[model samples]
Target: MGVCTSQNVQEKIDNIEDDYLKLDFNRFSTYQKLENIANNIAKQQQVDTIFSSLIQRMIASGQGHILKILENIDNQKKLGFMTKLERLDFEFIDSLFHHCYKQNQIDAFQCNVIQSTNCQEQNFDLIKEHKVGIVFLCGGRSSRLSDKLLSDIGLPSKKCVIQIMMERLKKILMLSSENKEINDYPIAIVLSDQNQEKFQMYLKSQRDFGFQSINFILEKSLPVIDCKGQVVFEQETQAIMTPEGTGTIFLQINSFINKFPNMEYIHFLGLDNLVGLPLDPQMLNLISKQKADVLCKVIETNSILDDRIFYSNRQFKTMDEQDSNITENSYNSTQMLLNDLYLSVSFLNNLKYNHEKALKLNQRYHYIKRGSNIQFEKHIQDIIEVTDITILHQTEDYALLIDDPRKAVIQLSNVHKRYLKLEGTQEEDLVEITPQMSYCGEDLRKFENVSYPLII
Candidate 1:
């Protein structure tokens, strides 16, 4: 079936009677029947205008091809599938093509480091009094982390990435309980639809990791566009889609913040980091003491893969200058790097405001080629260009991000050893397991608490 043409749309519009009779209360006393009559009349008049505007907007944004694809599906069915708000979301994505970041437009500045040990008891006291929340960005597929969360790396009991993180959260909560001022801290996990069910089940199996309340924020998935600028179909009815990037944390958690009006600070981190402390009091203290809107924990870039964290040290470039440097990878010259971000509710509000405004503008969309398909992704770090960010330098080992299976196994083993030492456990009691040792499908339930020796 072809899309409704202008004539077809006009016919529907022409059929709507402007002088339709208003209901008389005595003639139709039943409220339900009256409501149905009014709704049918309103829907008939509004459908043409709503759909015509949607199609025109898509055409204006160079997405006319999408309209053709959408026509092949049932028109009413497709419209019913997406709410008016959801349609606006697709429009916002289209605007990204016009208002993208130009590499040369950004300025970088080296940030200074503040040692965690330097924090005082007074700072900790303030942190205990502050109402803070933790957001775990766990939306990414563990494709790079061995594709299985349960890849065991020699633990006392066999545990996966999620299990270890749950344990870590339990410890943080336990520590928080020691403080009288701190009560009812909420932890939210931001997950994608693909992983939400599995993750929830896993959490339930782990008994909620002893946390009284754990909220979930599901990330919205945007449809993928092909080289021809047409939406790619995953199935007959569904479109191929990917999760909007980590920067989406601002929008996803906005409602959660509204619920807890007193939530002043949010500490967010990625899921791959096994050693990350959920609500590090030092970080909380730094943000509170500095009176900063955003406090980013940064480490000097030692590896090529690490993005340089930079302060906005220069003025906004002129339109002419921006146009001249709009070539491929032009922004790679900037030297500063970013680690992770801790945002205040005020900062989140600012981000939300900017994002809402940006959607109205004609923004450029940047696409990356992933093998045969192209992907559109944005980063939380990109906010540095627009927002004033305060940076605190920490060691690279503050948290370890697991990307490779073998390397992560080695790193997890080392982290485990360090954890044992931190607990004042002697090395002699450790029962080291070789790298060659596998679960072997045997009844190895007896191996619990048997620490495997380092693979060095």
Candidate 2:
């Protein structure tokens, strides 16, 4: 066969192997079952050789590991162990292991100081000229945010972050429009499995912020493994899975870009930054002037231990307090501009694997608990090591909700008061500036007698 669907290959395996239901692995008592399944697939003339080899590789490498983990456990107890991996999605695991087996190396570049400059365009002329899209890295799980949805975290005046983001975008579009026809900018939001449904419901309730087009992309999830390299599971049919790091953005880049004909660029941003986005023409123009494949916004930071610190001008290495490479300052702001034309699955995959290997060796892992399991994530910023990125320097002036939500409210209020030129305004004042009122606290002077804690 030239090519076969996963389902087709699965059916062929099922026809030849009697006991591998759903590839549960637990159903088979011996490693021989796995060997038989792989051998049968290879023996079939109708099955693709590539698929057969991949299946064989899976069996050859995974069988021993699987057996060693659940070695002495009884069959009933092993079944209860519940390693219900995605039955049909073996290719994903195969790709993952393939990366593990093959070391994709990134050459260290010569370290140099990244120059920063400013650009300003009141008309958003550059956005109108390019096939632009916005990506919100909103895949953060709500479990870490006080068990609340990221969209539901209320800002001052009970306005949620999602609402504010929508308002700001609407304002930008209106400001850019000349003929009164606001351009519908395509927005791609990367959401995680944990909060995707609830976030969708919230968006639906808000009528998708009155936008004509919005694309919700689920981030890729990785299986959780123990310290001993054994896969962990939560239930009989569900393995413990966590969202893959920001690197997954590449996995969906082509698909998201293809959604809009000739989509040229995408502005990747973090949703938790409450101050707002600088999606003006100047930023877009800067990228064009630099002729860069990527533009990353960084803020000056003197702390060597800050997790956001990106170091080594050539390698673009991320440093921790324990890492010997903490000789530099500055932090990745999670704000980036990318040319979609230069991005491809193969290129980014290699970058991702290389970056992840580096991260693992550096012990830059955050252990989060899910029931009885703990998992580590791969960060996407490591692409900085392999790509030429123009750095945009700016001061820290925003409230990031990645940590404490309560503090974010206080910080948000302080930033809001400063933006609105309200002196000595305390959090108790509850000042609310809707996105409709002002994109960045500029157009709010018209509203008079604004009551305390009310939307202006």
Candidate 3:
């Protein structure tokens, strides 16, 4: 008898076709069919040793009945033959199916709901004492914003969105620190593969904005899956792929958390919202005091049309009352959780587990087509149902979230206009409209007093 080497087994497996196996299964006995399929899978995938060992153990333990069930199903026909990377991708999608839950079913606990008006000195003090981290979700393709991140919004400094954010961080640390030296809190900038190099160069040119420590977590890209459920290759060697969205931060922050033992809560913000205070003391204080697992910041819309969707008792719904004169009521404006949140090392660890589970179960995988390629992505808010969440509301006038490029331009123009007015200078004279220079107003509002700061 010849010894069955991996090379020989692989050659045999490769010769076996799906149609041949299907026909063989119908004609063979259960045990024969099981043995053939297992051998093929093991041989082609280079897992013959593990597969054989498991089968032998199962047979020795009188659990061979399991093999009978395996014979009735065709693994290749159902799952398709996958490469190592493809297998990993499928496993991740499978886990998502288990963790996915209905977003509307999340329970909103209202105990000790913290408000901007109620935030006091004690809360600020608590915020200063607690160790909190900020995760900036900035590495997106920015295709909607013309592939530039607020590059058109700054003055002579020509600061990009990241530079503006770093400046804000410096201000927060300055205010919170007792000593003159700035306290370097852990900051994780989650970037996509495309933006990682460019953003790093930008930060280096600016001297990291006086930040003592910053961690850049570049998100991993997965192969694009076609309608036939096969990996789509862009070139002969390269597969078409995309970054897995903001939720990927949950997977990338483990090392950051490990390095900063004092870090308790994580605040997530998008780069577009220049006025957002990443480390707002009052918000941090609220999260700490309430012992909430998740915190969502929202603003009440002026009318039903403004708030097409609203949350009632933790359930999200479209406003049935469409009267233009409806009384003052809070409604959901954008799916973007501006000033969105997650917490404590323990909570994050758990979130990571749930996130992976959701991915494996196919719960959060949103399949969409980008031109000729198919992409799988997940939103950060998809995890809300699986988490304990609390919503903090602000008035619509006080909140600003930029979703459109035109709106962003208008908002920044308003800021520039306000700056000219405040400085007692006409835009025609003091402000230069050169192609190279653009100006956004300085942020003057005290962080503790506002939900979303008004830039002036």
Candidate 4:
């Protein structure tokens, strides 16, 4: 008798296939299939003894899907991105595989709702009392928008989305100074390695957009894998690496907080949302009064409660593919206000732990294609099982996510008019409203008499 091994099992499978014509078809039985499966499991255990880690344990303990993939990679001796297994960064991809193979389970919790009508308007005093931070998620590539960075997408004023957002921040700073809160707002921009250089070059050209200091958080870029779990390469020399996901932003939350010890809340803004108002005055007042730990700005589709999706007890789920149960009436704007004090290191670690443990059952996986390769991603909104959430019902005017050139022109123009409040201006008017002129729709009546094509 010979000692069994994965290599031996592979040879056996090959031999069986090679001799298929010689075998008696009626001799095959369920007992033989069960015997082969048991043998493979034993061989996997022997192979896993070489490494000590949860990742290895997962391959050994679970069905031999991952083990089979690795075996095929080894036999081929040529991965698309790299030539050998030793060249791969196993440690870096440990979590990726851990998440890819596990069953995801999101615990349900209750939610608290806050109506827009009940929220106090313009509570500047409350904002001045606490320290706040802004996190701009801009790691995304232009994708359908174009080859240009999403931050560089032009608005009606000839200013890009990044410029507009910075101007809005500058206005907040000015308001804080007027209220005697002179501390500079700690702002962080999450960027991927692919776009970091370009973004920095743009910022340098604009003199950091007049900011005294800005903190930049670089997101982890991982190699894209194909359907067969082989790394995909863009060209002959380089492997294509893509930004992990929006949820990966949470990994840096603790470090960002440590830098700004006094930050009480963080306003999350998405790069695609051209009209998002970070640290909104009304939102600030509602969260402050209610002392809610998490705030999700949602849009209601109908007046009926049963027809709408509510974040009851924090059990509300994001509209991701993983969520089988979806109510179409209401959805989130992807903007959120998170209480910094509520986000401790242990709490975030626990979330990460649970995220890795929770997996899709029945061995199902979802993949998205990017250009020439496919990748997996986990969204932040999908795993937000916070203790309590305050849902702010807002109009769709606040949820304009620009993804196409045609939509950008029409939607941005309409939002500009709404914010500027130039009543007499026609729908086709090219109104340019800068943050210096008005922070947020504050008595912009002066622009009413300006002209058909007014630039403020």
Model 3 agreement with the true structure over 1-456: per-residue lDDT tens digits: 887785675465445433233433234474565565556545554443345544433332233333333333355532232222232344443233223221223333223222332444324453365477788877654343214573655343355556666666666665566534464667778888767777788778877766777798877766565543445644233445677766656666788888877777777876655445667666676667767666666544334322112334224422232224433332323233443554556676776667554464234455555565556666564455554444343423222334443444345444544534433333322122222122112333222232211233
Clashes of 3: 17
| Model 1 bad stretches (over 4 Å) | 1-94, 98-130, 141-157, 179-183, 235-238, 302-339, 346-368, 385-389, 398-403, 414-451, 454-456
lDDT of 1: 0.51
Runs of candidate 4 with Cα error greater than 4 angstroms are: 1-120, 126-130, 142-154, 179-183, 226-230, 300-373, 399-401, 419-428, 446-452
Between candidates 1 and 2, name the one with more favorable TM-score.
2
lDDT per residue, candidate 2, 20-40, as tens digits?
A: 433555554455665666556
* lDDT of each candidate versus the true structure: 0.51, 0.53, 0.51, 0.51
How well is each residue in 343-445 modelled by candidate 1, as lDDT tens digits?
Answer: 7788767765776434522132335544555556555555544545444434344334445444544554454445334344454333322222221111223
Candidate numbers, best lDDT first, in rank order: 2, 4, 1, 3
Estimate, for each residue in 116-140, the C-alpha lDDT of model 4 and write its tens digit: 4344466566346546677877776
Highest lDDT model number: 2
Clashing pairs for model 2 are none
Q: What would the TM-score be for candidate 3 when compared with the true structure?
A: 0.59
lDDT of 4: 0.51
